[model samples]
Target: TNIKKKMKPIKQTCFDKAILRHRSVIETVFDELKNLCQIEHTRHRSSANFVVNLLGGLVAYCLMPSKPKIPVAGTYL
Candidate 1:
């Protein structure tokens, strides 16, 4: 079957592991913007209001302090 041909039991590379670890941060940012900021619900009567809100959100994101990245435990030799 074509599905069987595509199924290879290859080992996951380091890059794959890195992405799996870091992807959650990006998803959280999107969730926050949509839920907390009401960015998706913005409906302005004028162009100025639209621009101001969009720019304001972007500025807030840049100024926001990031959560500290916890250090991964090291294996002993």
Candidate 2:
């Protein structure tokens, strides 16, 4: 099958687990944003309301002191 053929090689290596581990942080951030900011709900009755809600949630997230962060190492690339 196509799926088996495509996944066969990837499953043979550890790279897939590494990639998933890297993405887990991003996934957790999105999960937090959705739950804490209530952005996942589509209850807006109007286009303007939807846009405002979306922007407001994002701005609030950015202004929060507990926002998720990735630590930086030595120097900038």
Candidate 3:
């Protein structure tokens, strides 16, 4: 939502609820990646180490039993 005026009878802009919901889900996933998976770190001694750490974190996330995901409407043949 956007407010166009600060005075009386303020005008407000409309926003899509679906887009906002999707954005919130994306943020939640990133938060989990950075915090729970420890994907964001500054202790890498070399580029290779950083890459390895990133890959490891991704794999760990994939292996987790429960994770946030977007639902698809239909199956594709």
Superposing all C-alpha atoms, what RMSD in Å does each candidate have to the true structure?
7.0, 5.7, 5.7
lDDT of candidate 3 over 1-77, digit per residue (tens) = 33347746653334455555468777988998999889996988899999999999999889989887766465322
Residue by residue across 1-77, what tens digits does model 2's lDDT show?
12364465533346665545557666778887798877877777899999999898898788877765544374432
- Root-mean-square deviation of candidate 3: 5.7
Q: Which residue segments of model 3 deviate by more than 4 Å?
A: 1-21, 73-77
The candidate that wins on TM-score is 3
lDDT of 1 by residue, 1-77 (tens): 12256698667788777656757765777776666555675569999998888777777666767632423565322
Residue pairs with clashing backbones, model 1? none
* TM-score for each candidate, following the candidate numbering: 0.47, 0.60, 0.63
Which ten residues in a row are the worst by lDDT in model 3? 10-19
Minimum summed lDDT over a 10-residue window in model 1 is located at: 68-77
Clashing pairs in 3: none
lDDT value for model 3: 0.77
